[model samples]
Target: MKKTNYHTHTYRCGHANGNEEDMIQAAIDMGIEELGMCCHVPFPHYRKHLIRSLPSVRGVRSLLSLLKAIIKDGPNMRMPYRDMETHLELLSQYQKSYEDKIKIYKGFEAEGLSVYFDYYQKLLYEHKVDYLILGHHFHKHCISNDYFGKEKMTKKDIYLYCNDVEKALETNLFSYLAHPDLFLIGYNQFDLDVQTVSRRICQKAKDLNIPLEINAGGMRRGLKNINGEQLFLYPNAHFWDIASEVGNDVIIGFDAHDPSDFNDAMYNQMIKFAQDHRLHLIDHFDFLQGDFKKFQSEYDIR
Candidate 1:
């Protein structure tokens, strides 16, 4: 398993546990050589008035309601992440702390929203972020904050989700797709409709030369049994089989939400699962490692 994970979260994300240093030490203990601290990037929420001139009271109420439903701990619960300046400063410290042992990269798990494209880009341009991973957590069709797994997914939902993912890939903004099969979270079955969308996603990733993540976070959450069958919502057996067939670049994302998640046993299990499926798993990605050097130079990151 090479001991590298780019899909890690921090305590500032509200739902995730542990501070950045805790996760860093955990990775070191697990013998990780590289760790990317991709904390959740802050997202902006628009007021109804800003978009359509709705009543002030109505706008506030609606925004609050939407935030409550979508944000696990609500809007004011956490900073979501340190501000860009602070984030970069922390990254410097973490890197210096483990200079000879592990490589730590600064990045964000950003939402793939056309509306927020400029916002994300601003971060990259102004903050010198190392990379951004595509995490289509919210449905962009309506720009709602509702997360993918919070609702029962229909084929229509699957279509919209995959479409958004494809759009994100087309932008060439992300280093890789985080939890590419996340649309399957609430979907219990791998029906023909699901298969169709999954195939489309894999093909698009192949076409774009974007790596799709086989996230291990779901394993930490455990498995779901549907129709007397043990199934995982993601790192989905069916999806990977299609990915293996499509010949898309695949990589493992620990999606570590906490320090404890950096366990060796869990890491080995996920790697074994990918090997069993014959999915193309690479230890590190050029875009994330070597290619990013060019990216940083282009952006004048240093």
Candidate 2:
């Protein structure tokens, strides 16, 4: 298989390290043929949404973080909207500069928040991004209380996450589902509810013709012993068992938060995981376009 990774992040996201060039050079050194820079998407008027979500803030830390984001408009979790133009412009320059070494594409790892659907559509339609991947990390808002990857997500939260993913996929905006089993990070145990939702997510992606990512980030976290079985937090054995059964297409994502994450060890691990699961792994995917007419009608845009 040709080495390619579509899920990569940059230092602009605050939580990650490495700049655009640092990441690109790493990919080229690792013999990656194509690389997509899909950092956590920045939002315009992010503080407005954070302020509106004040009532939903649950704990002191989360509340404080939200307040800080509202006040600073800095990279709380993502780059600020003010940095969006510069980020994309630099990426465009790198794409051209690195054309001979590796194919580069601009993209974002985005949340499936309804409030930002319009913004996502704008990003795609305006050619600002080549694609968006559904990395639904939060529900309703970007606060910690709504974070799906929190240490204690409820059954209701998982259901809401699944619903948001389905809604986003239906919009045809997201090219693939990133870490589709992210709920498993907090909600341990491969019980009936987990099975039900996993099947639903896999089936949805299968039907939509969007590939599900076997994210290496989860693998990098190391294995956890859950219910007598040691498994990666995501690309969870149980989840992929369902995905394999449902016959969904799979893609290996470095989900690189650092330049070193583009190494052969992680890549090989992902490949073997896909092979072990009997997943139909693909090296590339179609850059699905956003259906602006449908988006306009659904959002009641003129």
Alpha-carbon TM-score of each model against the true structure:
0.83, 0.97
For model 2, name the residue pairs that clash.
none
Over the stretch 144-249, how does candidate 2's per-residue lDDT look in tens digits?
8788888887888888888888988988889999999999888987778888889999999999999999999889989988777888888799899899999999
Q: For all candidates, what are the clash counts?
A: 0, 0
Give every collision pair in model 1.
none
lDDT, candidate 2, residue 245? 97
Candidate 1, residues 5-37, lDDT tens digits: the string is 888887776678888889999999999898889
TM-score, candidate 1, is 0.83
Q: What residue runs in model 2 are displaced by over 4 Å at the alpha carbon?
A: 297-302
Worst 10 residues of 2 by lDDT: 293-302
lDDT of 2 at 66: 86
Error of 1 at 169 (Å): 0.6
